[model samples]
Target: MNKKVAIIGGGIVGASAAYYLSTLPGGDQINVTLYDDGVGQATSAAAGIISPWLSKRRNQQWYQLAKDGATTLMTLARRANLSTDVYHQTGTIVTRTNEKDLHDLYVLAQERREDAPDMGEIKQLDEQQVKQRMPFLTRSQPGIFISGGARVDGAALVEKLLAQAQQVNLIVKRERVKLDDHGKVITSMGPQRFDQVIIAAGPWINELLKPMGINVDVRPQKGQLLELSIPDFPNQENMPVMMPEGERDIIPFGQGKLIVGATHDDEGQFDLSITPEATQDLMTSAQAFVDSLSADNIIRSKVGTRAYTSDFAPFFGRLQSHPHLLVASGLGASGLTTGPLIGRLLAGTLIYGGTPDWSNYEKPLSTYLS
Candidate 1:
């Protein structure tokens, strides 16, 4: 008999899992059912930019995972015959407005050792050099570092991956999941049994799995983002720029529109209301880097919550008590950058009998449940 796998959540993480699961050896013998309440409306939708360099400081293991994830997405796009326009290869520019933060950035750049292959040497850019590379930047800051990175349209990537998974016979279900006493998964729309279950649900995973004795300390970190439709706003040269103010990032996605974002609030709230204060804060911080960004040019704005782990790292690997259950959550703000690699690791461990060294990756479930 073939083994069946039930995946909860249809966002990037879950969708990536289904995609990779279909590619493994004897993968055709496995059946994958992906469950989601709202199709990519959570952290996946809120992902502004995907960059390996920005996430490099997290640690070497995470950096490798993120890099692999990005590479996998690019490979998938080519194989699927999809347009590569969704992924912008323009590198990011990390600018410093405050001297203190500038010093810290230099220290971080210096501390990167030779063994870290992913974090290549950070190249310092002068005002003219920065403008030469990314003319959209106003160059109001004194110091800027150009790091090799890439950006992806998070929403588009999710849709593309989901569509590709469907092509491979992966069942996609749009419904919430509930687990039984024996740790069996129960979906709101359908009743199905599986040999294995993976919970890649973002912010709602904790609540959905609590009754099954799987208490994930994942909290919702809300982020508010805005899009601008200024036609004259700089073109493709507009690279991803991060400002010291509120640690906001200004990302350009090719066209006249730009993605200005992200306020991190630990209140664990799920309301998508765009507050006046957040809107003003985003506009103020955005203007610091991109001088042309004004409130009047704003086309759309919304809020979304990302799932944050206690250690700020993702939760991967199988559950100790319930060996059949696996998890890949707590991606926080790096879901788009890390989802593919983590999904590959999770699927490899579960279906292929491979072992994943979770020493660097957060294993909160093992620590608490074991």
Candidate 2:
């Protein structure tokens, strides 16, 4: 008996779920139909930094989720045979505006390493060492280095996931979908029924589940990014991601492509327009570090809507009232870090029928949905 599964939102989570369902053992028994509107999807404009160990946030649950998510990402990269251009362990360099805060961060990373050693070597680098490691960096600040950190191209990764999933009869429709109270997926083509439905629609989850008389604690957050290309730059493809003391972090990709400034605009709503203000702000901040953010070097700008909760904790699992319905959102800025694991967990639970570990979460599903 083939189980028909319909996944709404073809971003990170949905694509990942489809990828695992198509590649894992016994995956042949499940069929997947994914719907993606492709407007303001957060993953498309993500800041793709996977160095969660250096975060100063006190939420242990979120920290664990992010840590595990980084692990899951590598596993999928290997299984899907993703190219170096899409994913790479370039490590991460974090800087602080205050020296004491930077030292505290180092101590925190060291302590965390005792329990979770996968963060790799943790060390401090002087200004000279920082510039030596990343020569393009002009304004070198004291920084800490984490060897296991990685970077990814979010859009490229999703494309690869969908491409691989399609090989196993995965149906992809570039349309929006809704859910009725009776448990059917409402599409423009017509009403469709599925044994299971997973909604990973980022900030748009409320709209998709509205007709079902259910609501989740999710809101839109617009993230703006600036992209630039430096032709013939030295080892630009291999430079580690940089996290300065602000919203703007520099991420380098293959072929001298550099990304900067992922602004967290909580009031920006679902608007996807790339504004000059954002572009200028990103470029100005980046200019302090690199040689140029000039008009000639500018490639483009991207904006995407992210999901967030009031307390900023993400929740996932089968609905208490509707067990066949699964939902995950409220990832906020950590979407790129946590989305893949949530997708893998959703697929595993749907197939293997086990309770996801909720001991780490303070409120679990009740925090976002009851």
Candidate 3:
């Protein structure tokens, strides 16, 4: 009998890890099972923007992971003969609506080294130029910075990955997991023993591992988003746009719909309910950029929770005492952008001889283990 590995959570991270693990040498001899209650529905809710250059100021580990993960997703789509259209690399335009914000953006741009190739160009666009590029804008914002970015239908990508994993005989289970002292996983659906287990359950990771002595600081941050339909706008298919309004981000995605969102609310207490206050705030912010945006154009709305760590960096690699257990969560808002590469790194550490070098990413297994 071959060694079995069980993974918790069926979101992008879990699915990507399963897919990558299946392709490894002697991977056919290993049994891989993925467990998730809600599967890809909960934590994956987002505009799924793949902007590697947008998160330049983050920790070095996260920056490298986001860059590599975006590349990995593009490569996977191409190799699977899936439509490259799934990844819309139209680039992004980030605007600064005020003097203070413009100064901040300038400072951020100046910090970049001239030798760095991942950084996008910081250029100013006048009112006429801004309108010419994005006709939906009623008036020009103070300053606009256009950069290389990409977007994807996150739900569609998950579906494709699940299908691919099924083709390779990876088991998919929808259930809550119960773990024993020896790191064996048992669920209501069935009981299975594995040599190694990976917990990628996002915000729910702590809830599941509290009994195992691995206390992680993963908290849920709720984000509310609205999809608007407006066919009258020009350059609708150009690419996604990111506007810096105070500390909030207004991102656009899909057909004529714009994903105006995101509220970092810790007071809500992990509830995934969309509050009217958040909805109103998002709509008000959206109108600041596009005056024509209204409640009537709102087609649908949803609220999703993202997992964040105290240090804002993801927790990966095996546990300190429980060598058979591994963890991969706390990706925060960058899960879509960093899922694949993290999956690759985690799978390599779990299945291969030891930890593998991740180029620019420096979160080695040693950093997590004592």
Candidate of highest lDDT: 2
C-alpha displacement of 137 in model 2, angstroms?
Answer: 1.7
Candidate 3 on 166-247: residue-level lDDT in tens? Answer: 7775888878887765567879856677888888888887777766665666777776677777664555666446555463
Model 3 clash pairs are: 91-149
Worst 10 residues of 3 by lDDT: 110-119
Put down candidate 2 lDDT per residue, 1-370, tens digits, no spaces: 7999999998899999898888778789999999997989999777588888877788888888888898888788888899877888888999876889888989988988887676889888878888887877778888899988888888999999999999995999999877787768999988998999988998898887777778778889988998888664677777788887764888887677889868888878898888777788888878888765587888888899999999888888888788888888998888778989889888888887767776574356866863
Over 4 Å off, model 3: 39-42, 52-58, 81-85, 98-123, 142-147, 232-235, 357-370
What is the lDDT of every predicted structure here? 0.69, 0.84, 0.69
TM-scores, one per candidate:
0.86, 0.96, 0.86
Regions more than 4 Å wrong, model 1: 52-82, 98-122, 142-147, 232-246, 368-370
Q: Residue by residue across 77-151, what tens digits does model 1's lDDT show?
A: 566565545665565667665778767766765564243344444766555776665566674454445354556
- In model 2, the clashing pairs are none
Model 1, clash count?
A: 0
Between candidates 2 and 3, the TM-score winner:
2
